[model samples]
Target: MKNLFLFLTLLVLSVGVNAQQNQIQQDSTSREKLDEVLVKAVRVDADSPITHSNVDKEELAKRNLGQDMPILLNYLPSVVTTSDAGAGIGYTGIRVRGTDATRVNVTINGIPYNDPESQGTFWVNLGDFASSTESLQLQRGVGTSTNGSGAFGASLNLLTDAFSKEAFAEISNSFGSFNTRKHTVKISTGLLNDHFEISGRFSKIDSDGYVDRAFTDLKSYFLQGIYKDGNTLIKALTFGNKEYTYQSWFGLTAEQLQQDRRQNPYTYDNETDNYWQDHYQLHWNQRLDNNWSTNIGLNYTKGKGYFEQFKEDESAAGFANLIEDDSDVIVRRWLDNDFYVINMNTTYKKNAVEIISGLSYSVYTGDHYGEVIWGSDLAPNTNIRDRYYEGDATKNDFSVFSKATFKLSEAITGFVDIQGRFVSYKTNGINSDLVSFITDAEFSFFNPKVGLTYQANQNNSFYTSYARANREPNRDDFKNGVTEHEILNDIELGWRHNTNKVALSTNLYYMFYQNQLVLTGGLDDVGSPLRATSGKSYRLGIEADASIQFCNSFSTSTNVAVSSNKNKEFKASIDGALVNLGDTNISFSPDLIIGNALNFFPAENLQLSLLSKYVGEQYMGNVDSEFSKLDSYFVNDLNVNYEIKPKKLFKSIMLSALVNNIFNKEYVSNGYYYTYDDTWSDANAVTTIEGAGYYPQATTNFLVGATLRF
Candidate 1:
């Protein structure tokens, strides 16, 4: 730790000496006149008084190997990442400001990516997506209005690679610990006859995870075509994912972890998850005039998947027609869903004011069913086609929003945004409990936001904003009859300073929630989530980040967040009784998070970096018991990259290596806890026993890669 501080000090001194000679420059002449159709609907304009960060392709390429998107964004402010495979490869998840994935809104271009029912972004379904992305923006809190679900916590918008003016081809491959391997191929036709361009990429990745049987096999592809004219641009694209991974959801208990953290609880050979997803999108942007611009986008997605699990000593009566034979069973749960969306945005800009309006309509249809594929010898007549339950769900959503920005003065700006949304959801057939039922609901919401930005000077600025957002319950919430609209009132105050060598930003936010759906670590047989409202909750935090350019070849970036999350008068169900836990800390919310990166270029073509992260302790249960806490951990990584200009054989060649968790620290990043009644222990009474499972992280791991471009 002392050495790290010393290095930071020297770097800062070096940066001061070179400040007058170095300045980040922007080329306005090369900027696009019209934004991509998919992103325009949700993105914020300049001087909008919103806090956001943009990540470009160059930042992604340094570590673009087999890891998922969440792992790549792990160093961002207020972000916590976890992986079920014990490594950053398959089934990874992220939480922003302690808010889980279900609350984070994700979009590709401008199209929604979260599952309508689960409200979760499955990055595995878009294998190697980082390879095709050109840029991404992350907005924190109840940010600007967007399509599909609301941004209750944060929003992630991704833009695919743009058309290249020059033709190019590239090949990349990587191999690493845990038998991990990745291969990718990409090409672009550049501009054809000065009017059209085509680009495509194919990728495959495989890994034997740190945990036993946590294997993953993934394949994906992306293809896009673009047509451009003087003031109009049109694009069409398709992407898909195919994945098969063994079940690693069942985590470890304290005793089991002590024996071996990598132990697998279940010994079934066929326990695995298989899935595939495909997406098609079309976008058009037109510059009607100097003051008017419009964008339109249409998207369709198809997804199907299933996970198989073995039940021990299951009740035979749960099967459709099986008798009570007191035998074990193996079952599979399947999901097939279809989603359609249409989004449009129009912007009018004149003088110092800009007005932008957007409209979006989306529909989703999903089928959920379970089948008993195998049975114990006592019941030998089982077949693969016998189903236990079948259910269907459909949702229709529509929204319209308008935002106006006005320049109040030479250094001050005012903004206003209003949105109206309508949602209708219905479900029929059997639920997780095998109970046949039918339910339907509708909701209407109006959200408003207002803010002001004060550009005190060229190098300093200050901003503040207030916003309100409402969200409807998801499928899981409906299954348990907690279908109430969740509401949030958010406030933000921030300041930013920028110069030739240093940039700094600090933001303070307060978010109040009504009837917030909080996770209880409970899951259905199929691993679908189950949540309950906490009645009242709030989160208050301070976020600060800074970056310094030491010289042409050296720089450093760091971010830190401190927060307090709490539930008012929390209550829990313990052995069929309501237990009040007064003013308890919210589960899974850490009070402190810190991230740092130190980069240096020892030579003109060689670069090296060190990344560090620290997360504070968090509780897994609302009661905040010591037994349910995940201890704080600090981890670091080392990265190196070298580039070569081989004029004879290839246009350029690059090599990269990443050593993760260099100290090999043993830690648990995530966990789940639940308490159940043990009536058998005392026939006349019930004993409440608490059970917990921990997801241990990998120690030291490495990945080495090479890229060839021509």
Candidate 2:
């Protein structure tokens, strides 16, 4: 805490010393263009042959009272979101086009953000990041070559807040249901002397989740310094978060849900997850001339955390050096990791053609271990903080890609993209189960893409694209005795129309897979979803979104997605024998999803919105058993925003309100299923029994907030 205070003091002093310096006059448009060059390699223009969506800061602020990024993006064309705490505060997840988060590539300023081993994006680590974001783009269905592991499902990239041109300060506070509260402070030494700028933000959030004992406490910070000149830009930034959240991944069983949906099975007070992560980034961009530009990015991340658990009557053999059986124990699992990345890209434009090429390299190392904090009975030589199991892992990844777009004729354009990725991973040591686990693997893949866009008229355009992607299995797959890589072939066709007051887009996509790692509807001991290899699978879907303005005071926007996701000749073991389930529905893949938003502007500064969502029933297991089906649900929310520009004390004041699940619907958005052999049912034959668990969502809730700008 002292170090933080000192740092802030130094920043303030620097800003004060430079406040009286003469400012240099420069074109704001040129500075904005240079800032955008940082992410141009990973993003596409509006007319590109890609299916994507854009969300700006203004749109995100409406519901940004206090929620994770996944919850903020829930209304996209093909998106589904869930939370372990039954609210959007802790342990949140997202799936796109019926694919899990592991397959979604996430990048911040062209640098990869997914965990190297798990290939998962944990939004909880960066609490309230939306506050510092300028904009984000979501490209669905292998839209382009990116800097991450692989975009088997989709790719998302975010641009941080652009430097302000003038000095400003802001404070925001909010209170919501479930004892939720958020506080934030932001400041900017905008455009110091017209060549430098300093900006920072501090935020803290707390919530008592809907489920019993599922509480969250989070603190986060973002700071950046920038230097800008005619065609040169340099930036240095750091962001991090510290969080403590109670465990809630143990979903309720059928009987438990029937009795009390909010009940948590574990009663231990200290069963919680605690983690801290910090990231440092540096970027340099330069425009050599009107036709050439380049960007370079470097990043380093440090993370360490642990989850504590209380075990009852554990076997002596399972824990090393335990001398007694049937003894209670409390343990903490720890992970310490460091990640480094370097990205370089260049863009060229001349006449009717444009080209972009980039290369990325990253290295990662992690240590996994467990320590016993307390036990009912300890051996003579045992002591607290002694590790019972330990492991180490290292990974390296490198990739290069080039993409080009050129006009083929007066009304037609052509696009081509190609990439090659190489990876190597190695691990050594004892696993959590007290077993020897060792692995060494290497992979190399080549991906190619092509597309065409036809501009038929002033208000209509059509496009089609085909892309291929290859993905390496995660660390869990290696532990489960699976090693094969997965492949995907995606095809997209779309049409878009735009006018002064109306906009519409429709997309048709088909994705074919080989050796796909499909979800098994089961979770490991630590709550990671389990997956298995399916020989062949496919997803065929159509997505449409539209917006219309009836008048200046009223407008509406709606989106819908219909899909058919299936696994061909799915096989499962039953009664000690393998059985083929022909043409089964893929687990966790809903057939239909719909979202709508109606906005009303009764006055210039007052706005009201009504939002609704509907999701179709989905199967939890590939076998499509009656017991594995999850029911469909429909939910709605209400939002209101009002602004006041005072003439005296402050610049502007904004008030916002949100009412979630207005109808108080009782619904389950996510769950898990598992099966086991029960030999006791019959002495002569084996019997397969199935069981399931559900994570119930929150009922009616409301939040109100106020922001003051000066």
Candidate 3:
């Protein structure tokens, strides 16, 4: 308690130190404005009263070699990332502010990246995307109104690389533990004819994951063209990836971990998941006059994937018009989806007021089906292509939003935002057991936001904001009989201080949820989570992060978050009886998260850094039972890089290395649990039994790489 008080005191003192300095110059227009068309509709201004973080290309290149995107963002506040391969290569997941990936709104150049059916981002589909990204922004709560699904937890928007004026070529390669390797080639045909430019990149990554038989083979390409003339700018981009990975969804239990941590239950050599995704986008930007601008974008995405598994002792009743005699079998499930979108925005900036408005329409069509590969049925006439179950889903999303910011005084500014959304969803499907189902639903929502920012001085400012967010459930929720959508009322108060020697940001937030969909830690047939709605829940937290530059050669950055997440009047069905379990902790919501990075530069071309992370204890179920608890853990890593500019042949040469888990800490980042009744007990009473599964992390690992640029 005393430490918290002292920390708050220091924060206030830091802001007050510059009270005698000059008052900051107020600008009607944002200084950090981007020139790209796709980002015009979703990005927030530098002076906007919102909590956000921006990562540029230079920072991304420091860690962009082999790991997935989530691994690159592990150092952010209130973020927790895990990899199923026990290394940072394949099948990784991230949670922000205790909310899972499904709740995070993700976009690529203002186009929705989350699956329309599942509402989740699959980073594997865009392999090595960081290599082609120009900048990205992460908004922590329900921020400014944006495209795609609702922002229940956080929103991430990425802008691809822009045109270069000078021709360039580069080659990069990395090899590390688990026989992992990455190869990349990039080239640019800088400003041809002084009006057009073309650039492209190709990447191939392969890894033998830490988990037994878990491997990934991925290939990707990115191509783009830019045309700029006078007041008009046009951009065309095409990017995609093809990936194949060995199945490792089934996790280990405590007993199995004690025996062999690397054991995989399935012995089949062909068990794997294969997928491919492609995206095409075009944008046009036009400037009408000195105070007006407009942008329009059209995008299309095609995705298809299938995961194959081995089933043992399957029942014959599950198949349609066939008998398998309860023999071993192999089966596969497939998904093919297409999405189309059109987005437009107009901006007017005059005097001390700025107004921006946008409209978007999107459509999605997805097909889901399953096939049986091999079985004991001796019927040679059966067609192998016949699907036992087939389903189709179609959805349309339409939304309009407007935002206005006006100066209330020389040092105060006010912001207002409003958005309206309409959705129509329809699905008809046959379950694997041949059971049929259909659903047709429509929903409407209106969200509003208001905020005020007070600029204290040239180096300090304070802001407060209130926002309302509503989110509709995904396809799985509909299949599980959930009819109503969720709502959140969020309030945030923050302060920021920046100077030549230090930078600091602090926020206090309260989030109230109504019918929030919470994780149940149970897996569905396709290995994804099955979620349930909690009647009432709330989260309150404090977040603080800062960077200090002690001298020319030493610097450090750190962030810490503390929060309490709880369910009110929780109840569960146990042993065929409803048990009232009063107020309890929300599952998978940790109370504390911390991250730190310390850097040292001994020479102009050499740098070293140490990274550390800590996560508090978490529960797998809402009841807070001892059997469902996961202990807290801390982990650290060391990274070093050296670069040299040659006078003769190559332009620049660079070498980098990373050592993860330097102390070899053993910990579990994620897990699930289930309880069932054992009716074989004495008399007529029923006994309960529980089972749990955990995904343990790898110990010590290393990766090294080299790059040559000309």
Number of the predicted model whose lDDT against the real structure is largest: 2
Q: How accurate is candidate 3 locally (lDDT)?
A: 0.84
For model 3, which pairs clash? none
The model with the greatest TM-score is 2
Error of 3 at 607 (Å): 1.6
Better of 1 and 2 by TM-score: 2
Tens digits of per-residue lDDT, candidate 2, 1-710, equal 33334433443443344333314333222334887887888888888888999999999999989889999999998898999998899799999998999999999988999999999999989889999999999999998889868998889899998889898899999999999999999999989889999999999999999998899999999999999987888999999999999999989999999999999998999999999999999999987655666799999999999999999988877889753588899999999999999998876665566677778999999999999899898777888888889999999998877788889999999999877788899999999899988999998887789999999999999999999999999999999998999999999999999998889999999999999999999999999999999999999999999999989999999999999999999999998899997999999899999999999999999999999999999998899998999999999999999999999887899999999999999999999999999998789998899999999999999989999999
Q: Which pairs of residues collide in model 2?
A: none
lDDT of 3 by residue, 350-369 (tens): 66766777778999999989
- Using Cα atoms with residue i matched to residue i, what is each candidate's TM-score against the true structure? 0.94, 0.95, 0.94
How many pairs of residues collide in each model?
1, 0, 0
| Cα lDDT, all candidates | 0.85, 0.90, 0.84
lDDT of 1 by residue, 240-334 (tens): 99999988877899999999998878799989999999999999988765556678899999999988888877776667555245668878889
Runs with alpha carbons beyond 4 Å of true place in candidate 2: 1-32
Q: lDDT-based ranking, best first?
A: 2, 1, 3
Q: Which of candidates 1 and 3 reaches a greater lDDT?
A: 1
TM-score of 3: 0.94
